[model samples]
Target chain A: GAGVSQSPRYKVAKRGQDVALRCDPISGHVSLFWYQQALGQGPEFLTYFQNEAQLDKSGLPSDRFFAERPEGSVSTLKIQRTQQEDSAVYLCASSRPPGEKLFFGSGTQLSVL
Target chain B: EDKVVQSPLSLVVHEGDTVTLNCSYEVTNFRSLLWYKQEKKAPTFLFMLTSSGIEKKSGRLSSILDKKELSSILNITATQTGDSAIYLCAAKGYGGATNKLIFGTGTLLAVQP
Candidate 1:
């Protein structure tokens, strides 16, 4: 694709429900990252992947938050038993290499009601 | 823990006015500092500063990093209404296997026409 693409630009989920957010990065991007942006705050790193390997997941807030990039081109962020505190924007970004410029997606706004 | 702080939570300025955004960071193994602009959905990349002293300029936007002071500044010359957005500052750090970014709260800039 021309740029990073994310699905379900907006989502409304009830508490305790699970939600899945998808991201399709630029073709052949070697590094993919997931971030969460709260209202009136900057994006916080969630996880990182190099190719198909999940190298880092240190920033995932809790055990309920999980992300995976099985094939390296596309990724998914799954939140289990969502809570009101999870209502925020989930952003995905990609870079050619570890220390290169990143391209971001439009993001999925999750509203837990 | 790595931390990034940006000054002036919000600013309102008239068109053609120049604005300077400040960012400071304290991190171990700092790799780079980045600037991003967020409007409606996602944040767009602006500049990445690695070395100190050298300024990176893109038309009306310019940024410089001061490694000695552990800070960076983004300057916009003759700002426009289109430039009204949240300016974010992030610092990249290498921890274990992957590099992670720590972002500040961001500065909301509103340019009045």
Candidate 2:
């Protein structure tokens, strides 16, 4: 793909439900990042990956929020027991080695009811 | 904690007007500052400033960084309705092992014809 691609453009889940969002980064990109953007706010870092290595997960809000890039290409973010506060846009970005410029995907908007 | 702050949460301007957005940051081991323009879903990369006092320009958009002041500014000249969007600023920091970005709350620009 010419750019990062994300799945499930919009998701509406009841409170306590589990949801999964997927991201397919640009081919051969070495770095992948996930960010969460609330209404009227900028995107906040969630996690980062260098190839298949989970180099950073400190930004994950809680234990219930998990992300993985097992094969170093496609990634998934799963949220368990979603709360109303979890409603936001989840963005995925990828960058080549050196990671100076990031190409982002159209995010998945999650609304927890 | 690393932090990024953007001023003028919202601004309203008419076509052909000029506007400047401000961003300040406090971070450890700062690597660079980046500007992004966000529309309905995705944020597109604009400029990345590493050296102070040097400005980067693209068409009607331009930005500069000041390391001594730990701040950056984005300037848009002859603004158009198409330029109406949220402008975000992010500071990249190097922790021991991983490089991460801290973003500001963003400045909302509304351009009226």
Candidate 3:
């Protein structure tokens, strides 16, 4: 079975640029999540989606960060006006439902200069 | 604030040794605890413990959750160099309000050959 997958393993962007990271969750998974992992630290929550609806975005550090999962399978995390502080690996994970085990993607390592 | 905390931010052990990792949390709507292992890329799921399923074991790795204490412990027997990675703990909140996974700082394990 295919696990979660992410595109563009690495990305380099200048400050104030916009970046979009994509994630493909396993088929039929109802819950999707995005996280930001800074160097030498664990991943921080970003947002979550159930089905095609965006349920939570409280974890988004600022308004510049937005994510969407239309049709409930493919998701994208877009960060507008990138900053050096946002330089980190963006991770995506999916689970059948809340409280279930989550499967994670390889992640996109974004380096903002 | 709701948070997950992991102890022993880093550990260095030789192959065949035993190791233990800890995770504690403080959240209003406690649901479940999860464990993950990561090496350079995305995190791999290790275990998910809820109120009913408190203890889980897979080969050399085992984990237990103490709901009363709001904590969990992961034990690895006969640690191997391949087990060297960062161990993360996350807590899921209850209710239908978006399954946000709050994460701990993580423990970096370096198993020496």
Best by TM-score: 2
- Model 2: DockQ against the native? 0.78
Q: What CA root-mean-square deviation does each model show from the true structure?
A: 1.0, 0.9, 1.6
Candidate 1 per-residue C-alpha lDDT over A10-108 given as tens digits, one digit per residue, 9 for 90 to 100 = 999999999999999999888999999999999999999999999999999999998989987899999999999999999999988755578899999
Put down candidate 1 lDDT per residue, B19-100, tens digits, no spaces: 9999999989888999999999788999999999999999999999999999999999899999999999999876677766
iRMSD, all candidates: 1.1, 1.1, 1.2
Ranking by lDDT: 2, 1, 3
Give per-residue CA lDDT, model 2, range A5-82, as digits (tens): 999999999999999999999999989999999999889899999999989898899999999999999999999999
| Candidate 1: segments with Cα more than 4 A from true spot | none
Writing each residue's lDDT as its tens digit, candidate 2 over B35-110 gives 9999998999999999999999999999999999999999999999999999999998765556667889999999
lDDT of 3 at B76: 96
Chain B TM-score of every predicted model: 0.97, 0.97, 0.95
Q: Rank the models by DockQ, top first.
A: 1, 3, 2
What's the TM-score of each model vs. the native?
A: 0.97, 0.98, 0.95
Native interface contacts retained, candidate 3: 0.87
**DockQ of candidate 3 (2 decimals):** 0.79
